[model samples]
Target: MRTGEGLLGRLAEGGRRPLVVDSSLAALYAAGSLVLGQETPAAPWQPMDALGRVLILLVSAALTVRRVAPVPVLAAVIALWLGYIGCGYWPVVNSPAVLLALYTVAAAHRTRTAAVCAAAVGVTWVVAGLLGGRYTPLPAVAVQAVAFPGVVAFLGRGAGVSAERSRRLAVLTDRLRAEQELRAERAVTEERVRIARELHDVVAHHMSVVSLQAGMASYVVEVDPVTAKGALEAIATTSREALEELRRLLALLRVGPEGEPEGAGEAAPYAPAPGLDRLEELVRRVRAAGVPTELRREGTPFRLPPGMDLCAYRVVQEALTNVLRHAGPAAAVVLVRYAARTLTVRITDDGNRSAPADSPSTGGHGLIGMHERAKIYRGTVSAGPRAGGGFEVELRLPAPHAAGGEPVGRPHP
Candidate 1:
């Protein structure tokens, strides 16, 4: 690994080798002090003796744990350096370790505490420099003692501030990422529910017709060949339509881009979703399934958003399918009404109210899906037996003008 990367990794793991740094600093100070003591003319610069060397090594060794306990390390180093100075040795030998301890304290603590510590250290250094007895000028000694520690403390405080900002930014970025994932999961759940409703509507409606026609064809095949042929033909057409609708739904679940295939616009025209415009065909299918069905419209019709249109269509389709399955030997009527700000579709069937408790029209997924679809547009769904003794499902949706462009694709009444 690169030198910088290796250092960063060590820091990240909380395993920085403080001993290596301290040993190197200790060696440099010991050798520098011996050379300076012999050459310098200052009155306080005494030759490096065994005691002075021991004191300097003690101060340097204390700094190995400087970051772990900066305040204690600073106190110990200051005490050892004072002993060295009292022995008539230059105080500069141990000054680097003192400054380093102050820097650590500044970075790890509050600004006021670090400032107080820096000021105390400066005063102590100034007194030690004065012990040189005018060898160094008073002004120069005071400035050196104060300015060096002050600058190191300032840099340490800045590092602390920068580290805090980085930590906060990391936390905020993680929170944002979590929220985005939550939203994505919620969207996926909603889309799955919609697709399931579509599948239920498509499969349930077409299969009901196919099943009924197949039964009719089998029952009348020996007695009436012509009628049997028509029933068989109806089953074939219903199954084909069911397959096409299923393919469309499957297309939505595909993992790639949802745009049409290359050259599809010309090869195969885009098929619009089922909507109120298909009510006539839906009614006819129900009529063929041996349920007399009627279609009616009131008020001026208007275009609808694709989602709202599909919602209305599915309500009607699901309601009629329930009629076919449970409302035995009955008739159904679908009414679509357009208002200034709302579109309503009501499907009623004059069927037996005594259907089994498990009927899809009564508290089943069909009814629940209707309500779910309506709620997406701030709409409502009401389904229950009417006062006049027939099942009814009504959907009322907010249909502001902004939801669509113009009135078109009106279903024939």
Candidate 2:
């Protein structure tokens, strides 16, 4: 059985006062039979006789089986006692078998069934007592029968309630654990997306610049030796810088103490991050890509947060890519201005050539990614075709480190 039921059964066995009471009563009956006058009973019906000893032994054994087969065993014990009464035996004071059977019925069965069994046993006890010349009032016998079953039923209900409560607690604990795991997984997913977007923006912009300068250096290797050398140098510097940044990002995936010295065999070469100082080279590469562009800077330059610099560079890169893909070989202008508390970047292209209908729209994840980056730095972005037949993208990013830096009434024109 379950733990709760087992505990109740053990407790019931412990509280068996009726068994002790019956043993004492049997001793009294034996003493009375031994000392009484010869005229009291000279036959086998005497309590000290073999037949009486046999009846007592049978009743004692029946008490043990009451818990296993209560109702049926109770019936057998009652029938045996009725036979003793018919054979002229006197009624005993205590009946352990009858008391234990009542308790078992209440503890193991439904309330209604236990009540019926208790009543039947009580009536049989009283009727047998009357036949044996020891009748008791009906009301007194009924009360005695009901008491044992009632106590057992109460104990059983208590055990059942405790079991139900434990089950509910277990279910609630599991639900809470599941919810915590889901939240942790969601957090990891969001961090990965943020990292991927940053990597894409960083790699794409620098790679585009390298491609443009490399192509230029190849074209003018002999025809324009001076310009070709300058282009090659720019290409080499850009490539070195890109490699360094990639290594730094990869290092983030390692498990180690911060700033620990690398072993000679473990040392990995890397490049430094590029900032606004390289804007000139970036512009030249776009120009070489056949999209004539202009680069302008305003306000006093100041240090920028690393994330902000990366985001600014990505916005420019994505805008230029869109122009090359969808704005045809038209001229584009890039303007960068630092004001009281904000930095602005605008790229505009006059749609003079018919862009291929199959060209992918700029309103996809590219624009969404840019918007997400801008929002990280407390900024806003607007992009669409201009009224005069050109596409324009404007971004405004806060620059807290710059003098006069603050959010503007609107993005710079």
Candidate 3:
């Protein structure tokens, strides 16, 4: 009736419990049989003697291990039942123990094996009926023999089926939960990588310019007041721009419950991301930092997808920053080519000096960021010291047929 309430259920509760519970069951059954045997008068049947009492105790004790070794226990209990009957004792006193053994066997084994056990117990009952029948009718004995074991076996089969289904459902639920956790962890790792890459690009580019302007301003403060004043102004303007870009990056972290910005109602909208169209402004800034820079366009230009546009612009900015920091006294030229199916940007410097051991152009975080950004668009970036002089970084990206490329809705940092 309950989920796990029968003989087999009690045995499966835990290790060491079956022995205690079954021993108690056997003791109760033995005591009841002894009391019943003493009360029965010596009429319609001979009264139980020492031998009959001993057989009843043996059959009750066998019930203790019915779940552990069901088949052997059933055989032993049936043999003891026959012995008790042969001693001229009423067979009904031992019938309950025999039927309990039959149910134990059915619950513990497959249907075929349980059915075989049922048949064996049924035959034993018929034998007991024939040998000990004093006043009971033969037809009634025949019906009892077949009906009792059959119904018990049927109930035992249902218990076995229910237990198996519960086990399988528990396993499936655990497997699905583990898979969901794994996927969540992977998504978190990817988002962290994206944020790290964006932070490196933004900080490296802006800091390089700030460092150059500050140094220039300090050098000319007393010698040429006007030149020094211009340098200081450039430094302040560059610092303000860097702060605005950092604010944009921080905006990515202000998420609300619905995935919108936390202060969407009060805060101003974010400015547009810089793209190839901003190359002229970028070149002017580098030139003002004492690196004579030229921007050139070869092929016809057209609008690109938002994701690809950002990727292209970041690559160029990273390359120029590397040139300013590593290629000492370099004059840089940036060439942008917008072909029918591809976009390529190449930045080359003409400094006679080789980069220091830890320069970004000489394989550092800046170069790595460039390559990572290009990869998002199925593009490639190559950077190294040019054979003639200075360093060069070139990137190539394949554009999709439609304007739609990788999504740009990803958080910047």
Candidate 4:
């Protein structure tokens, strides 16, 4: 049985040689039938002569072509069988040709075609049995003639269903992969834009201070050497500080997996971010930029959360930067007041001598970034032109605790 299965497997692979070999095997089986019932001495069947044997061989050869042209081969086999019946051949056992034709029709044809062929074979079988008078009214013989073809048709339908399911799964898998790739690309693009905005804000703010202090130092180098020397020293310190902060921001991009190479001095720069502890220095720098600023603190001193401290510092830094850029060298006031579980910082500037005809729009993205920072710590920011003159910015941040804790100051190295 295993050897026979191997031969059928080779035949099903469908080359011309395998097909021809399968046809020879089917013909041999049919020809052997001529003598199968004759060997039973108790009930001997009539034997075929040379002509009958030749017709049987022709029918078998026709059936060898069944897989390639099932309908035509089935017709030729049925025709040969009819002729054999007309020639007085009784109870012919060479019915393997018809069985092989039925299997081929079921495997190759659609439902309607297979049904028509099955009905025709049934009719021919009944007619032959009636005419030969060797027919039995038994169910077993009828089942043998029809059951093999039905099984073949069922298997063919199953194969079609399996193929369709596989195709659908492949399509779904491809679509999901494409969607995932698109989302990853979008995320990378957004991160790049955010980093660009941060770099612009940091560079513009620090560079403006550096340029102003350097100019002051150059102008007083001969007239007031002592003060000029002090100014130059301040310039150097400010430049170095700016460089350190820039390096810290850049470090965010250097992260890598465990197996990736590490850069020299793997420890991060800029120990902890600046906050309210440096408010006096911030005021001095603004003053050096030719902008007079007043700082006022009210209520009892209290500690603030780390996130709130950072947010407050950024708010003051951006506000003063905007004042120097847009508000000109005007006098500005900085007020910090803590009251009723909230800390409020307000920076207001009077009109500068060279103020532009139109102030920069509050709806601009710089203000939007400040608002986003405030919102992160459950804070609110309001900025607009004052009623009388100048522009004012008010930022209020919620303080969860009022009792003394760690001082609201810069992080220690």
* lDDT of model number 1: 0.79
Q: lDDT score of model 3?
A: 0.81
Instruction: Tell how far residue 168 is off in model 2, in angstroms.
Output: 3.3
As a whole number from 0 to 100, the lDDT of residue 98 in candidate 3 is 88
Give the whole-model CA lDDT for all candidates, comma-separated: 0.79, 0.66, 0.81, 0.70
Model 4 reaches what TM-score against the true structure?
Answer: 0.55
Tens digit per residue, CA lDDT, model 2, 286-330: 776657999877665666776787777778877876676667657
- Residue pair clashes in candidate 2: 244-270, 244-271, 340-404, 340-405, 341-404, 341-405, 341-406
lDDT score at residue 329, model 2, on the 0-100 scale: 54
Give the candidate number with the greatest TM-score.
1
Q: Candidate 2, residue 269: CA error in Å? A: 6.9
lDDT measured at residue 369 in model 4 versus the true structure, 0 to 100 = 66
Candidate 1 has which clashing residue pairs, if any? none
Better of 2 and 4 by lDDT: 4
Which of the numbered candidates is closest to the native, going by highest lDDT? 3
Per-candidate TM-score against the hidden true structure: 0.79, 0.52, 0.74, 0.55
Sequence-dependent TM-score of model 2:
0.52
Lowest lDDT 10-mer window, candidate 1?
A: 261-270
User: What RMSD, rounded to one decimal, does every model reach?
Assistant: 6.0, 11.3, 6.7, 10.5
By the TM-score metric, which is better: model 1 or model 3? 1
> What is candidate 4's lDDT per residue for 158-247, written digit by digit as tens?
554565678789999999899999899988986775576466556656776777777877898889998788777777777786787787
- lDDT digits (tens) for residues 1-413 of candidate 1: 69568545644564556656755766676566556645645554777677776786677677765666667778897777777777778766667777888888888788997898898788878877866434778888889878988998898888878878898999999999999999999999998887878888899889999989889899999999999999888888888888878866765555345565434544342357888888998898888878999998987788788888998999998889888888887888999998777888999988885564236444467888888989998999998888887888999998667455565555444
Model 1 segments more than 4 A misplaced: 1-47, 86-88, 130-136, 173-189, 224-226, 251-258, 262-269, 352-365, 402-413
Better of 2 and 4 by TM-score: 4
